[model samples]
Target: MTTTPAPTPDSTVAEWDHVVVGGGSAGALVAARLAARDSGTVLLLEAGPDQPVPRDRAHPLADAGRLVLAGFNWDYRANLRSSGRLEDLLKGGDGTGNPARALWERFPYQLGKVVGGGSAVNGAIALRGLPRDFAAWAEQGNPDWSWDKVLPFYKAIENDVDHPDHPRHGDGGPLPIRRTPRDRVHALDAAFWGECTRQGVTDLPDLNSGEEAGVGPIPGNTVEGERIDAATAFLSDARDLPHLHVRPGVRVTRVLFDPKDRSRAVGVETERDGRLDTVRARHVILAAGAVGTPVVLQRSGVGDAALLGALGIDPVVDLPGVGRDLVDHPSVVIWSRPADGVCTPGLPWRQVAARMSSGFDDDVDVQMGLLNNVESHTIPGFVDRLGWPLVVGMSVMLLRPRSRGRVFLDSADPLASPVIELGLGTDPEDVERLCHGVRRAWGFLRSPGLSARLTRTQFWSDRMVANDGVLRSGVRHIMNPGWHAAGSCRMGPDSDPYAVADQEGRVHGTENLRIADASLFPVIPSAPTNLTTLMLAEKLARSMKE
Candidate 1:
């Protein structure tokens, strides 16, 4: 056992029934649910900007027309490309540095730093993974988390405007949902889907409703064009609750444990306005997300003991799983030019998605979609060549990537960004899977529908797409670490070596300490994690009530 010092709080004024460490998707729900019960006080802390993103019509970035470059996003100028193949390729007189690679080459990890976190800036493509995703989680010793068990929570939080009458949906929920109109869909996207249909892929009406494996317009969480972020959806009503207090612009440095028993976490040490303070609570819910949560745990000496000892902090729980098993979709993009006369449509076009199998097996592991807001300025030396207002592109993500990475401390400073290694394309199969998706994307552009509206054709380069080996190499060269991430503090049964928390969201070896965020997910979901993260909060809220 190592000796650790319990944090000395300046005052007890920050005490509450529950203290939530983030103001993102999961954190918002934690404060909202606990404060709604009229039993105890709740306090939420967000290290980012205090004010919410204005949903006013004048806010252009927040408009439905373009990608949200909200001020609250944290650009961790960190590199995600584990393999330096892309840089070497470019250095060797390569002119085609595609936007996906060039733009994200140095600064890859774009994380939400505002009250609602990712929901404030994401494309709002709310979706859930296949039933197999949750079943896999259950198989990893996390029981009661199968799709059937978690479906009710998904229903409880979503207010699907298009599917109010649908059996699996809820009537009145916090987040508003609207399916992108098929007629309003971008012409290129419509044609791409049309081509997919001609090729025998079925039409999935709603992937969020758990029906997967087809092409359809995705649902965005919006009400009258304004994003319905986690802060606006759940934390709105909680603000009126007298017992709830949300403190923004405060960063949590480390978890505070009870002096008598270090195994019991009771509060946290925080930094705000250049001052250190303490916030005590009966129960502490770390909702700082996958990247953020592990940093807190490791700083508090909750990770591997040897690592903590090196940093002059004693271990609270010798769980080596705190920063292990980091997972995310290793993705790539394919850019194409539209036929000369077709003026670009204005709306952000991450509006639809297609799920298909990458290999010979029938199971769906690849997700292909048409993105409209392709930033061509970041394209290679030939940016002057592909001249258009907005470019059309095909982006692909491997749903079940076998490649796993890690998250760990940089210098034991909570303010420091966690060093994230997105071990993408390390697995040979992942490279092949992405290559398959690329081939499919090439096919889509060459199809009769898109072919008529696009330039004869173009790959990142002629050499890149020449053959299978080169294609896979090109994939490794331009792989994106993915915008979303998960699995830093994975939850599982005690018997598992990487089990940081148990099924109930309770961190192992600690009392009154639980995790309620994407950090608890053992693996990244097949779908965008926004909806699933909310579902996790709903389920955890219900579990606490029980």
Candidate 2:
């Protein structure tokens, strides 16, 4: 276990009007807004280092890799459980070798432990939820969370490139949204869009207009040629606020509640500098992402009584849904070499035009620029060298997956990694849908524009493409998660017995305690989750002000 420095006398006992538990995407936004609202003092506590961009992880694109290698990111692991006997599987048993299965069985769900949390090291894709998504929330019992009510908040945080005249989009919102310029688009990306149009798919000019059915270039969280990570956008400038206090490197052990009331979360107990210190707060908001939030809840005695008792924890709240209903987008990559000279795979004109015309099929919801050079460190031995580059590839992700997973306590020890039960593809439809997505990718590659510039590579090995079963397996092998975890502390009406918070992000049964992060998302939207998360934070801030 990594030890944090002891809190000095000046830091140990301080009172605040609102205490924000995280400094990442949602937490930062909430803190900034709360402070700006003239709400009394607010304290932001982060478990990672104080530095914005740690020295070890210098490059912006390489931060994810650094977090994975170093233990800066929450390296959550899990045990595998069979979909056939999920209950029995949870009881502890051997797991199948499927990556998702292994995720449930062997590895703990990893979350970034730094100040910016996962936002500092994410693929910066910014997408808003579809109208149908919010309507579905109302249908599911969250009436106040309908699209009509939420659209204003969504618009309040976004500044779209195409529609500058819209009054809804705020020019001064902390989050930045911009179109990927044509000069930056790769040649293969242009071909992909061209093929989609040729196939007769309707092109969507803007996916963020709350209509997310068609295809277009994925919008990113970038501004002024630099990635606007949550830490940089929300926390850096606001740090000087006299009302805001930020404590880095402090690991919150558990939330402290009044034993008599049980509903009131009075404060939090944390270990700093090898010593235990308790800080009191009238309001406590948990923004520890899907994995960390539940863990904190369970540790603080707010979960299934039986499970808590088994782990020797006294139950404060018997919320069975504390660690259930997890969802994530799984993706696969298709690689091809272009016959022409190296594709200038940055933001380019051909790529922008293609993105503008990319909606050819209903199946492919969002299309990102597939670069010629693979710059990911997750894939072993593949590096993007400006010269002598021979391989090019595009990653195709399933926009909406039917798979559901969970995060649970592996042991009573709060320090041990939690057990993540990712039941991916257990639903036969999920597997079939992914297979269909791969076929769609094949169609896009065969488009005249792309085909004119590229040569085909084997699906896995040259021999595997001929066999349908092999092709399916290859797709599965190449696919990995795009992160974007949500739904652990889901928000909704009382009908959802497991939901931890209400529409305003206020934790159920608690007066001042609320959850202001991704953990409150009841359903993972069809688009990328980062922007939606920021929107939620903005909405939460407004609700708090009112």
Candidate 3:
């Protein structure tokens, strides 16, 4: 919350020390950090308006439905050309469905068009990947990006409330971290944990302790019962800072490069209020999430030469990895009615934490989550209160997925939407892994305690008991994406032709320009990416300063 002298507005020209395109999770964090460093003027341009989160929409139960239906958000559609193939395998038919076509025909990928971006609408799950996740970077030839080098950045961005003795978590960082309170613990959750122990899965105490290979209660990026979106965590307080200028309703059309030398990016050309404006900056950072950053680069003529040429775009930088290697976590639901007591409303965050701390049995496959409907008439409510005579039901997600996809330009126009193909479970192993997750969820629901509370629902009743063909179909019916999209613009060593950026997040062969966002991750982390993107922004800001 630092204050400095404001820059004089010009009727003729727009100028800044740094121009950050896209005000999503990554953009907000980078803007706040750069401005906090007292670096010269920084301009943050968002393509959408600043829409406030309504109380009803903010509720965890309500948020899920809203995310799938809301408009002000950038609801980018993902093409599942691969998923259709999987369907053909099961149904013995032709696989030709196009989700991207269907969605773009109506809407777009679900990117948050508002100020906070996806963080404003995400499920507040705060998780970090295993230490080996980072070590893998070194193996790929990025020496400066090993686990040892990036651990400090992770610690600097978090404020953990649960394990005080833990060394990796910070206590006073801008983002707050804590488990759900005890009062909110639902009965279904307790039963689920007990079953997981019986099934030999270990209850992990922390997923963010540089070890994400196990199961645990999902930690959230929430502060005082509200979602701590990136904008609120990084930019809200910093809005008054004179060094930072956040423009909510501006769309960047392209990155402006020096015509004489394409190696250096000068600034950006944007459109606002039906007028075009160019903002000059010594440095330019693109933090426009996965799909956006790549599209921006392509529009700026920085992608595959052939692809660019085909689109009538002259190539500036021929980086083939600009829109490849997309990854995301997919989930499946197993619903059942408890035999007895009313299924509680809200998650039992505290009870789950206590179980984790007590050295509970080690069942390490699926993380069991307890979700309840308190008041809102969302999916949980219909299932728990109205759909049938039931107490509660639960869902478990496969945290780590092996699936990979891509983002590509559908047309050369910057205003035209890009193609995002989420090749979910295309890999046989990924399908098997998610099926295992579904089995684990069923085990927890069918346990002695939980099973005694209610009757099993009929939609998948006969299919649930079967071990072969029907099970796969049942899993496919329920499993969808967690909406954590990333890795389109991967980072790697100079030798990697597919790498969009180097270890410092600078786009390959480009000077005075960088990409500091989820787009920079060579591989998507095991957890929700909001906090990790913020941590990356903090690290990039420090790196730029030095």
RMSD of each: 6.6, 5.4, 5.8
Better of 2 and 3 by lDDT: 3
- Enumerate clash totals for all models, in the order shown: 1, 33, 23
Candidates in order have lDDT scores of 0.76, 0.66, 0.68
Off by over 4 Å in 2: 1-14, 53-72, 78-110, 337-372, 376-391, 455-458, 461-468
Residue 5 error, candidate 1, Å: 30
Tens digit of lDDT per residue, candidate 3, span 1-546?
A: 332345643432245678899888888888888888888778888998865533354544234312323645665666653433323322433333344435323213466787778887766667776566667766776677677788788778778888654677787678778765434545655565566566655667676777544345667777555667787777877888877777888999889899899789999988887788788878899988888899899899998776677677889989988887888777665555544446444432223421121111232334446544323343421434435533243555555566787777756666777777777767776666656666555655556777776576545564563575777776654556666788888888878889889888989989888998888887666566777777778888899877
Full ranking by lDDT:
1, 3, 2
> Residue 196 CA error for candidate 1 (Å)?
0.6
lDDT of 3 at 404: 84
Sort by TM-score, top down from the best? 1, 2, 3
lDDT of 1 at 36: 87
**What would the per-residue lDDT of candidate 2 be over residues 1-546, giving only the tens digit for each residue?**
221222343664455567788777888788878776677777788888765443233454333212242455766554323333334334543322234443344434456777777777665667777777788777767787788888788777766765676764555556677775545556566566656667665576665766544556666666544556777777767777666777888887788898789889989888777788887887888887887788888888887676777677888878888878877766666666556565532322112322221223444443444645432343322443433345555666666677777877746775756666665565666666666666656666666777677765534443464466886777655555667787788887756788887888877766677888877778878765888888888888888868
